[model samples]
Target: MNNQRRTVLKSGSGAALLGMLAAAGIITPGMALADWNKAAFDAKSMADTLKALGAGSPADSKDVQVTGPDIAENGAVVPVGVASSLPNISMVAILIEKNPNALAATFVLPEGTEANVQTRVKMGQTSNIYALVKSDGKFFMATKEIKVTLGGCGG
Candidate 1:
């Protein structure tokens, strides 16, 4: 009985040590770092979302191309593509004006990587889509209006 108790205590101590190591950063965490804040994104207006994402005083960029259908037959899957011709592009953020949440997606563009991204998002109504790019520590932005023929959320 004494031997069994000793073995249990050893096991518990080992588990505690491993947990400590993980917490101290000596061991890798189980999940990847997800630094995204959902609550801030959920209710932000377009301009506020831009500020929250650290894109201060973004200028209009003609080099940033936002390609999407002028009108979407279905609002459920409105395809959008964004590409940038600027150098040192770090990030690309997508925002929809008419959604309850303005910010839809944010992509991290690594250095020496192609500054382009494609994604589909649900739109409740006809709205403007904005592409925000972070280049050389400064922010540049572009916008395109997309019309929805039929409402995806509800007509």
Candidate 2:
């Protein structure tokens, strides 16, 4: 109980300070938010998704790696991982080719951070999953097929 009170007090003071800073025009509300790529997330096709993300016709690359089960018995929660060995990786995204929305997830990496992420995405059926990466102002891709025995995404 004492720890919870301390956490609340500490965070409350931090938030108050931020509010003061915002009121003083030291920081704006917009500066505190990350840019949301709504168009890419809402795109229904791979080509459209890529276009929304400012990538067109990405080349195949072995430097990008995708790790997931060859066959997922349960499609509701399929574990997937992506990593890239290429230099200057600024962004990475996961794509499920057969899903209603081809783009599943996207990550924006800051400078010098490791370009690797693990996530779980719903699969309606068996599909080719891709790790699309943007490095040095160019896009590259790696692909793998995942067999889903069950349906997710209302399939």
Q: How close to the true structure is residue 7 of candidate 1, measured as C-alpha lDDT?
A: 49
Which residue runs does candidate 2 get wrong by more than 4 Å? 1-34
What is candidate 1's local distance difference test score? 0.82
Q: Which candidate tops TM-score? A: 2
lDDT of 2 by residue, 96-145 (tens): 99998899999899998898999999999999999999999999999999
lDDT of each: 0.82, 0.87
Against the true structure, candidate 1 reaches a TM-score of 0.75
Lowest summed lDDT across 10 adjacent residues in model 2 is found at: 1-10
- Model 2: what TM-score? 0.76
TM-score each candidate: 0.75, 0.76
